[model samples]
Target: METQALDFPKIHAVLRTNGTGEVTINGTSHPIQADDEAAVLREALRLITDTAAHLGRPVKVTTTDPDGQGLIVVSPEGHVSEAAPAKTAPRRQKAPAAAPLITSVPEAVPAPAEQPAATVAAPVQTTPTPAHEPDEAKQPVTFASSVDQSQSPPTAAPEQSTRRSLKETSFLVSAPVLEPAAHGWRGILTKLGFRMEPSAEELTEREDIRTVSQHWPGPRTVAVVNRKGGANKTPTVVMLSAILARYSGAATVAWDNNESQGTLGWRTEQGGHNNSVLDLIDSSQTLLSPSTNAAEIARFVHHQTSDKFDVLRSDENEEGDHEVTAEEVDIAHQVLTRYYRLIVMDSGNTARSANWRQMIHHTNQLVVPVTAIEDRAEAARLTLQTLESRGGHDAELARNAVVIVSESTDSKRSMSGDALKRAKAEAQRIADGFAPHVRAVVRIPYDPALVNGPIRYEALQPATQRAWLAAAAAVAKGF
Candidate 1:
């Protein structure tokens, strides 16, 4: 066996093995066993090929064997030649000098960057020869013609095509001159996007109304409230608490203000608690003694769902167990604000109740759920009236107070065309009556799912039920 050295400009050697039976690259040896020789040869050829490619230069490998068979080829420009001969004649040749010629030509001649004076003059002073002359003589004539054609000014075909397209588009868009009546109709049609008629329901719902409230820093303390019972206020509070817990992952406290009945805790599965809101109110005298630590007062609050929310249950036996003096309510509110990011109170419908007044005053939002029936409408009106009386009439509160119409049937049972019309008229009258006093009045259509007590956020109808969640989000935005 003989050894031969090959130069590869691009690839650098990473490893090599002993050259006895097998040679390795950078200590990675391969035995010349069975078909291993072919693999080694292939790897070596690949290395040279890659090296040539990287260096941008060609390489040639040859073995000293008598067969001249183990030969690898690479091009000077880093290209591999699989079949081409390794040695070939040179391709470059020197140009011969020629006499200068000049001739008349058009504008826009592209002069060479460093053309000699002789070359520049040759094109300008070319002699005009006959086109039908011998091949050798016609060559110069053809060259001169090509030079002249290249220098000639370009025709404006592109500009003409563009102008034609613009003219065609303008013609298609142009309206015919019309009579006064026809022109007016056409203008109206155009303004209405050519729709002859649009849905009345769509038109009425087109006006997008958004809720606005004062931005309160720290935890978003929302009160789930409605003056009237069966308005799904308790269910709304439960679902809102779950949604708030799911969204914020922060601890929330659901205060059961239904003193007459522990409905909130019962519905939420947090019943059988002795230290209810009444207990807190009874103990407020000692708890709110200016000397009592606010943090300690917060500890009396019981957790309903571990880290999620704390439940403040009301006494079921006592008639007015949740009732508290104004001072206790004020102190409790201050302590709650310090401990919680949110405080959702399930308020009763009685407008005369102290809890109702306190909740309306301290709440960031007053969610008033009403039924489509006349009685529920009256209750909603009263609830709104009570809130306005307590908080003072303001545009923001009026607009932010969500009047959700619960227990509505999708089959038009209660929302018949006449009933809907009446409801609309009543809603308008209510809105108009409280104009400038109520900020906004939104109607949440009744969802059947809410009838089965409190439902999760995901269970509610996405289109209609979202009004409540949107209202909650709007209320949260204040924080």
Candidate 2:
């Protein structure tokens, strides 16, 4: 076999050892005997060479799992020896990008004094699975196998909450009429007039959906927040609520909290009452009364006929100079919480406002949405940082937050598929950094229908709808 181009100046292997104090390789415990040790050493060397060969250089390997991790060095001749304990580097402050996917050799390993400068270089991260993620979501994209340095016993990987695929759906329902005699179960069922319900391929339950469904806690608040305007906050709230409502068959509402002029109300059904959240608060006495229930609450809110969720419009009256104060929000929160199974907030751009701060405090899960634009991303980063520094009610929000990178670019411009892929890849790259800080990252591709106006999931194209489902599933898992 050709030599792999792994030009690493240093390499260290962190291995799991049995009670007998011998390292296991490929399921054999304590490969201490000549043959077993040789096999273990050979496998380790093969892993390194294959990894280095892919990069066409000497491979670097780093092991910094602090949970009783054992380390060893592989000689060029394929001999395995214990790594110096004191010589090991300090705890890894941050894992490299490729740490999630490709091989990561630590700078902890000491290189021979004669090694050249070109050999000791930057770590090669896999367009790697993830920096903060465990198992890099457990299935790091088939780049290569990575040695798990965790000292804990092996566990099953958790399912991914978001779908990362860019491929469009190809499954289409055929005409209800059976073409000919049935062959398979689908055709036989179709011939029996069962095609209308469970068609040839319904493909209704998606991976993201199944994952999210596993963690369904009823009645929670998800705040769609970003300090930057036009970051698709309202759209994010609408789309996510629609997706959750559709799947969970639960009552969902999008509450717009803009202090001044806001547009979420403009896009949703105005309902029977011209009333907004302010009106709901004003009638809080009756709304929150023991006699009142969800049906009565709908009179004050807008209900979307096409979509199952409701909308609580912001104070849209220009004359009142209506700014929703925390007290008013509290009243509405009390009522809305009682009635709605999920309350998604379309928050304002002002992070400093009392309303915004209160929303963050009450938020069970934070969903920070940002467009692909640089400034918007910066604003999102700032928002997360501010939440972290706030320290009171919001410090943990940044840690448990879901960062949704939305593609607000107009699809009408007709960008190429490759360009779209590049954009998605960039979004994933940003999300990789966020994986360590937030619970998960969700990406919503640009949908022309959602770019502006009222959002109806039915009106969305199949691809757009799929994207929303994936985004919502990501958030549902966190809940």
Candidate 3:
């Protein structure tokens, strides 16, 4: 190509290694291999060029072979011509004159001559001045021009400007403009006093606020745990992460704390297995340091569908029983607390582990997924009892813990008449037993697609998904 001055700050260099050597860009891992180096460099260059062009700048490139040297030039302006085109400056113009004022007057009456002295003598009158008098002969005098004399024509007043300004000042001194919609039936009861019931739009807006409140991080860390397989914990974690991402727009991590092979990583479709929480803990132990930089740890994790969510994969090796330790979990909490607005621990079932209990202790909310089955209800109750026995009796834990019944097909769990009745009774018992401490007992109906793979939020059947989103909303409300 023709030579031209580069107009961008810098052009990225793609280092290609012959074998398994690591590639570093600006002292950071390149995150790609030699086989893909050309393509990566091309893509990076394309992005840089597009950005420079958008900013009216230029980016240039240089290449080299196996050895350590090459030259590349970039310009802050993307001009390629030998001589940059001269920019034609804009010219100023005079402002137009204001519109003229017009006033109307009634016709004047002629003066009546005096009939006095019975002789109606000719009225003495002064001679009028000639129209063509010379300047020197005429008296030098000035009169206000009609253009300046007439008061500006009355302007129509704006209707609400004054009222709006008053309202704005009152708001500044007294209250915010966008206050929360009133709550409960009292709002409906007091409609005559301007305490009207929230409109549909207002209710929708309140729901959004509630959703935001649920996911924001506070003083406590929360983990959603279920030890049983096929409990929908992974999907729950993913959806929760998506919601948190949508709300916070800050760093949020979904940790696949399950040491055993799990689906958290698979759901996000990220491939690397070399770096995970397990690796981090192991590296920390070997280094003998308290590592708490989230960006550093984040470099090893995978990004989920949303930019806000990151994933820490489970151990890939099937036979590996390596579990998260109490110390490691604490370290993770300390590190995560500094960087993330919300950290979602997808700790798969295996509540028997000491580490799992520690995870629960660190969390602000513990979501336990139960199916609407007799056995599942019994198991859920037993799990609650276990939590109570393990020192989860504090008001915070009691109030924050939730048991969600999953896979409800027809609002009932079992086919047998007696079993169905028992299931309903069990649900009520669970709700009643956990009352005051537990916020609500919710249900998630059976959706076959969830088991197979991730589904789009919009594609889910409205009835089932709406209930799920409502449950999510409830979860958010508790937080």
Could you estimate the TM-score for every candidate? Answer: 0.44, 0.57, 0.51
Per-residue alpha-carbon lDDT of candidate 1 for residues 97-197, written as tens digits (9 for 90 to 100):
34232222112212221211110001112233454655334231111121222232322334332224544343121222211111245447636544222
Poorest 10 consecutive residues by lDDT, candidate 1: 115-124
Compose the digit string of candidate 3's lDDT tens values, residues 254-371.
Answer: 8877746777877775734457776756655433345544446655677656335778777776667776677878776665665567777887667787677678767777776666
The whole-model C-alpha lDDT of candidate 1 against the native structure comes to 0.47
Better of 1 and 2 by lDDT: 2
Where does candidate 3 have its weakest 10-residue lDDT segment?
140-149
TM-score of 2: 0.57
| Candidate 2 Cα errors over 4 Å, as ranges | 1-207, 211-218, 411-422
Name the regions of candidate 3 deviating beyond 4 angstroms. Answer: 1-205, 213-220, 271-274, 283-294, 392-396, 409-437
Using TM-score as the measure, what is the rank order of every candidate, best first? 2, 3, 1
| Top candidate by lDDT | 2
The lDDT for every candidate, in the order shown, is 0.47, 0.63, 0.51
